[model samples]
Target: VCVFAVKVGFQGKEFAESFEVGLALAVGMTPQLLPAITSVVLAAGAKVMSRHQVIVKQLLAIENLGSMTVLCSDKTGTLTEGIIQLHDTLGIEGSPSERVQELAFYNAFFQTGFANPIDRAIRDSREFPTSDIEKLDEIPYDFIRKRLSVRIRRNGDSLLITKGALAHVLECCSTVETADGSLADLGPYREAIDSRFIELSNAGLRVLGLAIRNVDTPHLHKEDETGMTLVGFLVFADPPKADARETIEQLRDLGVGLKVITGDNRAVAESISKRVGIMSPVIVTGTDLRQLSDEALFQRAREADIFAEVEPNQKEQIILALKKGGQIVGYLGDGINDASALHAADVGISVSSAVDVAREAAQVVLLKQDLGILVQGVREGRKTLANTLKYVFFAIAANFGYMFSLAVASVFMPFEPLLAHQILLVNLLADFPAMSLATDSVDPEQIHRPRRWDVGYVVRFMMSFGFASSIFDFMTFGAIYYIFGGDKPELFQTGWFVESTLAGLMILMVIRTQRPFLLSKPGALFLFAVLSITLITIWIPYSPFSEKLGFVTPPPMLMVIALGVTFLYGVGMEIVKALFYRYLAHR
Candidate 1:
C-alpha cells in the first residue's frame, strides 16, 4: 500500500494519502514480535536449567552451550573426584621407600599457603613422620616453575625440600638416590627416572617428584633452587567419578567433544582420559607445546585430547588455539589457575566449589560437580535453540505470505483488502497461540546433535513455506470473490480474517515439532493456551463484539469455506515442513 500510495503521491496526489497508506501497511504485519518471543524463550530455558543445578549467569550464554563443539575440562573436579589420596610412594632407584614420603610430608605439612587436596593428602598420609619438623623459610608454588620449596631445620642444618611436577623437580636436582644407598650423578639415571614417571602416570596416579638440597645458610636465594638430590616420587590417585564415563559418552553423542587440560603428568592425564573415554593416541605436554609454533600448535590441539603439564597461562593458550581452529569451546575448571582459561573460552563453566576468581570468570556454573548434569544442560540449550527457530521461521513465513497476498490484491481490488484494525486483530490473535511455543515439546532427534542457527537454512525455509501459504491465501481470495459474493467490503474482510487467523494458529502445532503433531505431545499449559486462543479467535466475528471491532458475521456457507481453506492450508504446511526438514538433513 505504501509503495502504491507513494507512486500516486508522486503523480500529484496529497501527502496525506502516502502517510496513511504507510501506516496501514506497517500495521498489517507484526514481525516486531520476533524479538519479544526470543527473549521469553531464552528466559524460560534458563529457568528450566536452574532447576537441574545449572545456573546461567548470562542469558546469552545459555544458547552458546548448544553450539559448543569442544569442551576443554580440567581433570580434577571435572572428570574425576578432586580428592587426592596418597596411594603409593616409590624411591628413585626401584622399590617402595619411606624417605620420599618423609621429605614430601614435611614440605606439604609445613606450607603456609592455602591447603589443597594434594597437600592435605600428603599431610594425612600414614607415612608422615612422628618426629617434629620446623620450617625456617618457604618458596610458594608458582605457575612458571610449577613447584614449591620449603626450608626446614633438619639435624642442625637447613634443608630446602622441594615437591612438584616430576620433570620440573628433576631439572633442579644434580644427583639421584641409588639402590645401594648412595647418591649418583643424575645424568646416568635420567632415562630410568623418566621411564618410571611414565609407568606411574600410565597407572592414573599423579606423581610429584621430591628433591632436597642441604644449605648451610638459613636464607636461600633463587640461585639456591638447583644442585639438589632427587629423592623419589609421591604417587597420588584421585579416582574418577562413577558417572563420568557415561557423561563423556553422552557428550560425545551430542558432538560435544571433551579434552583434558591439566597440570598433572602426561601419563596421568592420558590414563585418566582413557578411563573416561576422552583419550587420543597422541599425548601433548607443555614442553612439547613449546616446540611448536602457534599455527602448528593449533592444528595439534584439534586432534590431541590430553594436554598434560600445562601451566596456568598455557591452559589459556590451548583454549585459544582450539577456538582458532573454528571450534566453539567451553572450559570447565574450579581452581585459581583455571580462571584465565575459563575466561578465554566461549562458554566458561565452573562448579559450585570453585574458587571466587574461577566462578566469577565462568558464565555457567554447575552446583553439582558432575558432567552428567552438563549433558542435561546441553539438551535444554538445544531445545531453546530449536524452539526459538520455530518462532522466527514460522511467524515470518506465514505473516509474510499473508501480507504479500494483501499487497498483490490491492492492485486489482476496488476496496481495501483489510482495514488497519482488522489487520491488527489477526496479528494479536495469532500472537496468543504463539506464546505457547516456549514450553512446547521438542523432538528427541532434533537435539541429538549440536544445533546452531544458519541464515541460509532460514532463507530456504521461509521462501518455501511462505510460498505454500501464499498459494492457499489465493485460494481464500478466489472463494471470497466467486462463491461467497464478497464483493461487499465487510463480507470480504470477515472471510479473510477467519481464514488467516485459523491458518496462523493451526500452523503452530505442525511447525513446532519435526515429527507429526499427533506423535509428540506438547506441554499441558501450551496445549490449553493454543486451543483456548484458537477457539476465541473463531468466535470473534460472530459475537456481539464484532460490531465494535469493525467485523461482520459471515453467512454459514462462508464460514464453511473458511474452515475448508484452513484445513487444506494446514495439510500443505505439513508437507512443506517435511520437505524442509528433509532438505535440512541432507544439507
Candidate 2:
C-alpha cells in the first residue's frame, strides 16, 4: 500500500499504471501458495509413509518426524522383538530349582491381572498341572509396587508367592529359600543376591525375584506381601530383532541419534544397547535423576545415550529436557505411563497394539513396530520437507528478483515496466509449476540428516538467485530499447514480461536440488507441469487477448531472441546454483 502511494506521488501522470504495478509487485512477494502447497506435499508424504506400514495420526507430525534429531524408545518392542522367553529359574544358591520353578508357575497362573509377556513366558517354559492348584487370593501388579503377590493352596498347604523387579521384591523378603528348601536370614545373602542380579542384568537378561512363604490366612493384600522367603530368580531374555543391529546402523547413517529410555537398570540398558551395536553409551539412571533439579537434568539430557531405571511418570521429564535443549525429539511409547511423554514429544510414535491412552496421545502409530519401519517413515518425512523448502526458495527468489527488476526499470523507462495485470500474471504462472514439487525427487544428501527451516539459508538463496535473475532482466531491458525498438511503453513492457516469465519459471529446476539441473532428473509430473507453464507463457503474448493485457505482438524475431536470452539465463543460473551449493557444502 505504501509503495503504491509513493509511486503515485512521484509519477502523477502515469498514476493508474503505477498503482497497478505496485499492487502486482506486492502480491508477487506474498507467499500466496505457502499453506496450500505445504498441505498437499505433507499429505502426499503421509501416503508414502502408510505404504511403509507407518500411519500418521496427526498431519503436522510428517514434518516434525523429518526434523527429529533424537528418538527415545523402550528397547522392548521397537529395537527388540517383544516376545519374551524364560531363560532360567534359579534358587538362592544360583542353581536351577524345581521349587522355584513351581512357585513361579503357580503365581503366574493364579494372578487375576492380564497375562503379561513375563507370565506367559513362565507358563510356557515349564509344564505345570493347573488342575491341582486352587487360587485363594491375589494382589495385582502395579508399576509403583513393581510386584504381584498371590496366595494359593495345593495338597492342603497354603503358600504366598511374589515375583517382580529384583529391588522391589527383595525389599519384602525376610529370609532366603536356599537349596533343599532350607530358609536362612536374607541379610546374610543380600549383597551376593544384589551382585547376582547385576551380573544377570549386565548379560541382558531381565530378572524377576521370586519369593515364597507359608500363608495361614487366605486373604492377600499389600501389607501381607512382606516377611516372605526369597526363593530365586525368574530370568527372561528378549533378544534384539534379527535386523535390529542393521536398523540401528541405518538410523545412525541417516544422522538420527538413538536414546534408550527404559525401566531397566543402567547395566541392563547398556547391555541391550551394546547387543544392538550401540557403542560408548552414556547412562543416566533414574536414581541419579531423582536427585537432580530440572535445570541440571536439562543440561545433562543431551549428553546421555540411555535414560535407565526411570519410573513411568518420569518419562515426561526426560522428553521435556531434550526438547528444552533444542532437540526435535521423537518418542516411542505404549504403556499407560507414556501418555504424558507422548503428548509432550515433538512427534510421538506408538505401535498398533499400544494401549488406548498411548495411541490417542501419539501423533504416529506403526502397524508394525520396528526401527526399520521408522527409517522408511523418516525418508518420506524428509521428502515432504525438501519439496516444501524448494517451493519456498522458488517463491522468494523469483518474486523478489522480478520486484528488483521492476524497481530499476520504472526509474528510467518512460512507461510502467509491467502493467498491474502482467505482473500478477507472472506471479501466478511462475507458481503453477511449483505446485507439482511434491512429485520431484529430493536430493538424498539433503535429507541425510534432520533439517530445520533457517531464515538465513533462505535469504542467501533469495539474494543469489534473485541477483542472477535481475541481471537477465537488465539485459532484456537493454535489448528491447536498442535492438527491438521500445519507443512505445507497450513494446518494452511486453518484451521484458516475456523474458522474466520464461526465466522466473525456470528457477524451479535450478533450485530444486543441489545437483546440476541435468544430472538430477525431475519426475514426470514435475516436467509436464513445467512444460505446461512454458507453453502458456509463449502463447499468451501472441493470443487474441494480447491487446486487453496491454501487450502488442513482438516483431517476427523478438520471441526467438527472447528464447535465446532465456537459454543464457538458464545456463547462468545453473552455474550460480552450482557455486552456491558448493559454498554451502563447505560451510
The alpha-carbon RMSD values of the candidates against the true structure, listed in the order shown, are: 2.6, 2.5
Kindly list the per-residue Cα lDDT of model 2 for residues 1-587, writing each as its tens digit. Answer: 65666567765646776767777777888888999999899899998899999999888899999999999999998777988899999998899878889889999988889557888898888878879888898889988899999888889888888999999998898999778777899999999998999899999989999998788864666988889889999888998888999998888888889889999878878888898888899889988889999899997788988998889878889889999999999999888888999999999999998889889999999998888999999888998998999999888887778788887677567677787788888878877788889778887787898887788888788888888888888888888788866678887777777888888767788888888788888878898988988898888889999989989888867788788898998899898988788785334
Model 1 ranges with Cα > 4 A deviation:
4-21, 27-30, 126-133, 178-182, 217-219, 278-280, 584-586
Per-residue lDDT tens digits for candidate 1, residues 478-551, read: 88988756568888888888888888877777778778777878877678877787788779888989978777
Best by lDDT: 2
Which residue runs of candidate 2 sit more than 4 Å off their true CA positions? Answer: 13-18, 113-115, 126-137, 153-158, 214-221, 407-412, 582-587
**Using Cα atoms with residue i matched to residue i, what is each candidate's TM-score against the true structure?**
0.93, 0.93
Clashes of 2: 0
Worst 10 residues of 1 by lDDT: 6-15
Question: Model 2 lDDT vs. the true structure?
Answer: 0.86
